[model samples]
Target: MIHIEHVSKKYKKADNYSLSDLSLFIDEKEIFGLLGPNGAGKTTLISILCSLIKPTSGSFSIKGLTYKEHKNQLKQLIGIVPQEYALYPSLTAFENLKYFGSMYGLKGKSLDEKIHNSLDHLGLVKFAHKKIDTFSGGMKRRVNLIASILHNPKVLFLDEPTVGVDVQSKNVIIEFLQELNKNGTTIIYTSHHLNEAETFCTRVAIIDHGKLIVKGKPKELINNNPGAHNLEDVFISLTGKALRDHA
Candidate 1:
């Protein structure tokens, strides 16, 4: 459902490309994972796809609609759950959802029902009236997810959706995403959690230094690499053990 062709991005005053000639294809309803170390261009690629930033050259299209020509239509087709909490600390959960739902032009009883049902599904029904500032990290993450999917997007892009949550919350989020994929939403996810991506993704691509190194099913990648017993082993084998510390 997504096609990226020779896409590259180099920020102003930067010496090298953040993403260089990256091309990828993701099928409809597939759970695709983009894995890499810090500064590996995963976020750059995602940001370009989300139209939050423009590419320095090359292009991409979502469901055959390019951002330059189909910006509004593409917006309706995709949802983004950013790594950061994109919530208002002052707004109640219900209020926050109501506002986001309206962004997609949903309103009235329909929006209300959607918000309540999502809240219930994500185990946040009891805190619907609670302010976001008062919620824990897990609660905030759940609410952040709810905000993105309220419009029932056909393609979802999530950047580290379970970064700091507890195990229970992570499980719930993964299960919820699996259900969404089952119902026909194409998902593009990026995470450092190799174990989660190994099982969750239908296919994964490992990129580094703004280039594609390998792309395959987790099991296939693991089996193909001699001495690699798991996705983590395969990952470390390809990306290496050096720390990716950045300012």
Candidate 2:
């Protein structure tokens, strides 16, 4: 569970806030999607929640624990899979995962089993001993996911988890996440893929220019918006058809 109260973030010397009074609550075991255009503060909000950066104003708490008071506890409670690959190009998949597992205080047979099982589950068992530099984009993405969830985090924050992968990889990743959710892991995701969010998320919130524009179930949002046939239609209707290109 998560609670946010009037959370706002403004970087020093910046002309405007990246997040403005953004208050949101994510329930336990819920798959929540944070949808937004380029530079729409989705990443900023997630970074704040992950404690990668402090909010300029207001605050948030995860599972009744604030980062200010429970940084260590929260670290144990959450996992993050960033848009970029977090693997070491020079390290073998198994070695890289072992290193990550150790960061969470895991070791020996238990950690080894966890790593092998995850690699097998993600279709990377054969590549476990291969250097990350030798992996394809999809393989690297799967490895990235394995690294984050090695500790079996209660909440998982994923930014564009399936952005560049082929359809097979994307399907596997989504199915893996769905299984995690079924077993009670809360997921907070951000993506430009509205179709995936429509079926994957229990609830979604669309924001733009650092403000919440709409929040609801995908079906509810589509039905409420007259003439909308799908989540993409509803998204375009609210966020518009303009390109969100940013440097």
Candidate 3:
């Protein structure tokens, strides 16, 4: 289980906290989502959990592993799919996966097989030898995902995994995630795709202004809210339509 306790963050120049005493518990094998308007600190929370940054105060642990005590072990336990492409444009898809796998001490036949399998599953087998610089946005996104999961992590943290992909790519990505979840990989991801999250996520937390406003199963949240026909309705009702103008 992932335990977050009284987490908070305040940038040097920022007046308000990016996250205000946020606390959450994510269960094992659950597809947990953090839904929020821009500047809601979704990214900030994920970064803290991934150990990319330190929180101003508070603490968190995953499966009893704290970043402070088990940084290397924790890295092995979790896979991260950052918002930006972490690919080297000059390398071929296969070459890129090879580099990523080696980072975790994965090599030889098993590693090669894993790379091919992921490529085939993600419909990138034909493009395996293609340069990342020549791949489409969706293709690169798919490759980025494979890089994170090649070592088979216990938990996966994805930040906007499907931001600019086409419908076909999105479906493939979501299906792959579902398969990963079924195999006992706990997934915690952030997304703006309300419709996709509605069906894909088992439960979701809505955050805004660096605070959690609501959380529940999508169907339950929608059914309970009067006149809420879908997750988007509930999202808009709770988050409001105003632009989140911030630095």
Candidate 4:
């Protein structure tokens, strides 16, 4: 469903590429995980795919729709949930959803029903009438997810969807995503949680310094890498034990 060919990107004033000649193909309805250290270009690759940042060199297309050829069509085909909370703190959950649904030209009873249904599905029904400022971080994240998928996108890109949340909240988010993938939403997500990716992803790619070091099913990678018993073992073996800090 997604094809990335010889995709490379280098930031202005940067001495090296953020992503280097990376080519990836993700299947339809697959939950693909991009795992990496701090400066491994996971975010850069995702941003390029979402068209948030133009690639310095290289190209990609989703479901045969390239940004250069069908920007509007691709926009409608994808949904993005960034790491940050994309919500109005002062607004009620219902109001926030209404504004987001209206952006996709949906309104009235149809939009209202979609909003409430999704909210209920994510365990935010009672909170719908409450102000967002009163919500916990987990609630905000769930609401942020609702905003992105109201249009029912074909491909969803999520960056750290479960970061900074309690175990209970993280479980809810992962479960919701699983349900979405089961319903045929192709999911591409970046995460630092190796254990989460091992079970959640159908396939995963480990990138470092803008290059794909390994890509395969979690079990396959663990078996192939010497002394690796799990995804974390394979990850640390490849990316190393050093800290990846950047300015």
Candidate 5:
């Protein structure tokens, strides 16, 4: 469903590429995980795929449509839940969602129903009228996710959708995502939660220094790496124990 070819990116005056000729594919309905430590180019690659940033070289296509030739179509084809909350603090949850849905050309009673259903599913219906600034981190995260799927996108790109939530909220989010996947949404997400990815993802790619170091089923990767017992073990073995700090 998604194809990336020799994609590369370099920020202005950067010492190294954020993504270097990286290539991969994600099948329809697959939950693909991009796992790496900080500064490993995961977000850069997602940003490129989401068309939030342009690649310095190479290209990619989603569902046989390139952003260059099919910008509007591609915009309708995917949803994005960024790592940071993309909500209006002053707006009520319902109000914020209505604004977001309208961006995708959604309106009327159907849009209202969609928002309410999503809020109920994510356990935030009670707070629908509350200002975003008053919601807890978990509530805002849930609202953020609801905003992305109002139009029912074919592909969902989530960057750390469960970053700061409590265990209950995380479980709810994961369950909600699993439901979406079951209904045919292809999911590609980047997360530092190795354990979650191990069980949640159909396959995963481990990247470092702007390159794909390994890609496979979590069990396959774990079994293939000698002495590795889990995805975290495989990750540490492949990416190493050193810090990836960058300015």
Candidate 6:
């Protein structure tokens, strides 16, 4: 479970707030989606939640623990998969994973088994010994995902987990996430893939210009918006067609 209250963020010397008094809650075992175009503040919100950055104002707590008073507990309670590939290109997949696992205080046979099982599950077992620089975009994405979840945190925050991947890789990643959700890991992910979120998310929030626009079940949102037949339709109706170009 997650709780946020009037959270806001403004970059140093920036013209505007990246997140402005945004507030929302994500329930346990729920697959929650944050959908927005470029410059929509999705990543900013996630970064604040992950404690990669502190909020300029207001507060949030995950599973009854605030980052201020319970930083260590919060660290152990969540996993983060950023949009960028957070891997050492020179390291083998297995080696990279082992390093990550150790950060969570895992060791020995247990960590090894976890790494191998995750690699196998994500279709990368054969490439376990292969260097990350040799892997394709999709393979790297899968490896990035495996690295985040090896510690099996109660909540997983993923920023564009499927971006730049082929359809096959996307499917594998989505299915893998669905399985994780089914087994009770709360998932909060940001994505531009409306169709995927339409079916994959239990609830979704569409935000723009650092604020919440709408939030609800995908079907409920679609049905409530007249003439909207799908999530994309509702999204366009709300967010509009202008390009969200930014520096």
TM-score of candidate 6 against the unseen true structure: 0.98
What lDDT tens digits, residue by residue, belong to model 5 across residues 1-247?
9999999999999989999999999999999999999999999999999999999999999999998999999989999999999999999999999999999999999999999999999999999999999999999999999999999999999999999999999999999999999999999989999999999999999999899999999999999999999999999988899988877
Q: CA lDDT, every prediction?
A: 0.95, 0.95, 0.96, 0.94, 0.96, 0.95
Per-candidate TM-score against the hidden true structure:
0.99, 0.99, 0.98, 0.98, 0.99, 0.98
109: Cα error in model 2, Å: 0.4
Q: Candidate 2: lDDT over CA atoms? A: 0.95
Give candidate 2's error at residue 55 in angstroms.
0.4
Compose the digit string of candidate 3's lDDT tens values, residues 1-247: 8999999999999989999999899999999999999899999999999999999999999999999999999889999999999999999999999999999999999999999999999999999999999999999999999999999999999999999999999999999999999999999989999998999999999999888899999999999899999999999999999998776
Better of 4 and 5 by lDDT: 5
Model 4 CA lDDT for position 113: 95
In candidate 6, what are the lDDT values of residues 38-71, reduced to their tens digit?
A: 9989999999999999999999999999999999
Write candidate 2's Cα lDDT for 197-220 as tens digits.
999999999999898899989999
Model 3 gets an lDDT of 0.96
lDDT of 1 by residue, 225-244 (tens): 99999999998999999999
Instruction: Write the number of the candidate with greater TM-score, choosing between 3 and 5.
Output: 5
Clashing pairs in 3: none
Q: Clashes in model 1: which pairs?
A: none
lDDT, model 1: 0.95
Candidate 4: tens digits of C-alpha lDDT, residues 1-247: 9999989999989999999999999999999999999989999999988988899878899999999999889889899999999899999999999998898888999999999899999899988989999999999989999999999999999999999988888999999999999999999999999999999999999999999998999999999998998999999999999999998
**Model 5 TM-score relative to the real fold:** 0.99
